[model samples]
Target: MEEETDTEEEKLLKRQRRERKELQAKIQGMKNAVPKNDKKRRKQLTEDVARLEAEMDERHQQEVEHLRLEISKQVEVESLANGIGKLECEDGEKTAQHSRPTKAQKRRDKKAALEKEREERIAEAEIENLSGVRHLENQKLGHVLAGRGLQIKQIPSDGHCMYRAVEDQLKERGSMLTLAQLRSQTAQYMQGHVDDFLPFLITPSTGDVYTPEEFEKYCDDIVNTPAWGGQLELRALSHILQTPIEVVQADSSPIVVGEEYSSKPVILVYMRHAYGLGEHYNSVEELKDRTTEIG
Candidate 1:
């Protein structure tokens, strides 16, 4: 009887343990099953925490860098800029009179002064004394035509003279012949006379001005050959002579550069009288009236 009782008790204990395990599993599953909406909320919270951490790290780094830079800037015995009177001089001239400005500020001030000075000087140009290249017969800017023709009063040979070509072309073509046309024709004729030029004068960079050999070689290239044709564009030549060159509108005599005035342009011949290389005048109107004599 006792054995049967003991077996019964064992069976009862097993059943209770199984029920406890099932109850525990049910409670765990209930806890794990979250609402669908809460999952997104938890994920957003995690992401926000991570982002805030990153921003805080970045802010800390920026603060550290700012402090370090401030310290370095404050530590300098010498200037950080180079443009104005330098912190250390090459000539070793020390100035006790001048108050020390930051290197950058000093440079900016110095630049402003220099630009102001240049403007003042340009503004103060003595137009009366300004003149063109001294042509023989002391050709003033206002010389009248006598049909005597241009001769090599200066430079190269009398035969290779450009002054005559200019005069001849000007007289026949009228004073309105564009500067570019004159440059082109002058080069074309000169190269025609000298047949040995190698590289053609299709593009006129500052390639051969100082040397005679390069000049002759280029002369033969562009102008010497009858096979090349009558004349490479004469107007192109005149435009090439002036660096930082300006052109005037056909309707107006206003000086125009890259963006000083209009952007759209019809490339016309450079009018020689347009630029006052021969004289000085502040305005184009001054150039027209006071600068040149029509007679």
Candidate 2:
């Protein structure tokens, strides 16, 4: 009968601890869901959580007191014998081991959590650093180009910068051509004139010449994916638009890649050692004629 009573008391204590844990979880959920801007709702949630916390604390105190009283009764029944006292102390130590984390365990858990947070912050800082670099590079380019009668308009840096820059230049010239359409047209031109591009499209990774199959796959990526453009795409676009493509670099003279076989003229502005990376292109436009007009 005594053993059965002890088992029932242990089960009751376990249930009380489980209930307290559940209450703690609910309180945390309510706190998170309550928005700071909603003053009335936030206050209501705060009060509810506080009330639940108070009840949990009171229950915990009652359980602790009950356990103390039971231990005292057992001590008296055993006539304060050393064996009974040692057994009780051992049981108490076991309970402490199960319920409380050791200092070293707590430190390890805290260290792991802090390491994860540091990695997340570092990732964010890297992205911000890249953006700042791009912004500074643009300012420097604008300062140099303003001396001439031109300034560069920034385009989206998503591997599609080349296509977007060309599109921007065309838009200024009163033509509305989407990047996708231009990509498709350029791919078709290259496919029709394989001999011109096939030699250059040699597999860079393997140092082997491009097979007809590999060339087709590469063309597909240019048209469908967000792959970047290079001299080859510029040449294809020039042929398709039937215009000369002029790229003005920072260190060298203007590099004209396509023939001026048609009436349309396209000028591309490029900056070397820009954005702390490779060369990048921007759309060039002429400022309004201010030589004759007075301020």
Candidate 3:
């Protein structure tokens, strides 16, 4: 009986897995058929995919419940076959003859424990996969840029990476500005335009708006310390230099800042895992010839 029950459970699980694989393949095909630029179609595709995934999850839950019920019925039958019964005492109270857990109960407990362990392993793997995904994205960005006759000129992994990349691009345009000078100018520009940048400056730890004094200190750090630069600083730099800046990434189209300033924008590549030291930026330069070897 136990062997028959095991065979049935295995068959059901195998069939469900096969169905899930086919559904996933169909969804992927649907996504591949849609063009990336068609925002409406892509949005609709996203909704459809989400709906399908939810349905699959619900179906999987139902199958699990069904299997649990089947196991419970089998356990009850096995217990009855083992002569499980109750005895009446002198006080007319009934007491179970068996004091220890039955074999079927132990099997059910073991299965539940194994399922919980598998879930925990999956959760841990997902956390590790975040970094893995970023690494893969950086590689994809390299391939995309290579196809466009451009290559990433790696910048140092220091906190001044953004400024350094900007400085490198500016040099190609005949603007000889030191990293320190660029930092100072960016800091000064933000300090002068507090109303523009302050609204976005929320304290990460407290999740509150920064006081005027805090904002001032932030600007000061941009100049005097190795503070990291972000989108706000990029905007400020674009305006200060009076040149449009383009940030390219793997997952999306290039983002143009200060587009009003110039038609020819300075290109910078944003990377998540290129340097292994957190978010970094690299300068983009055109290849000299079509025959140039690319890695």
- TM-score, one value per model: 0.20, 0.54, 0.54
1-295 in candidate 3: lDDT tens per residue? 1344334445555566687798899999999999999999998797556446534543454455566568789879967754533322322343544466779999998997997687567546644665687769867886778787888888986668889999999899888999999999998999999888786666534647789999989889989977767777888999998889998988778777798995578889987555321456899888655674365
- After superposition of all CA atoms, the RMSD between model 2 and the true structure is 30.0
Model 2, range 1-295, lDDT digits (tens) per residue? 1344234345554566577688788778887887879999996685456445433443444454456568679858767686786898689888786667679989998997897686567546644765776677566655555666676776765557778889988998888898998889988999999988786554424647689998898789889986667777888999889888877655446667566666656877765324322345678877455462233
In order, the Cα lDDT scores of the candidates are: 0.35, 0.69, 0.75
Q: What would the C-alpha RMSD of candidate 1 be, to one decimal place?
A: 39.8
RMSD of each: 39.8, 30.0, 17.2
Worst 10 residues of 2 by lDDT: 1-10
Tell me the deviation in Å of residue 271 in model 3. 0.5
Q: Candidate 1 on 240-268: residue-level lDDT in tens?
A: 33212233222334333223333222222
Compared with the true structure, model 2 gives a TM-score of 0.54
Off by over 4 Å in 1: 1-107, 126-128, 131-218, 221-295
TM-score of 3: 0.54
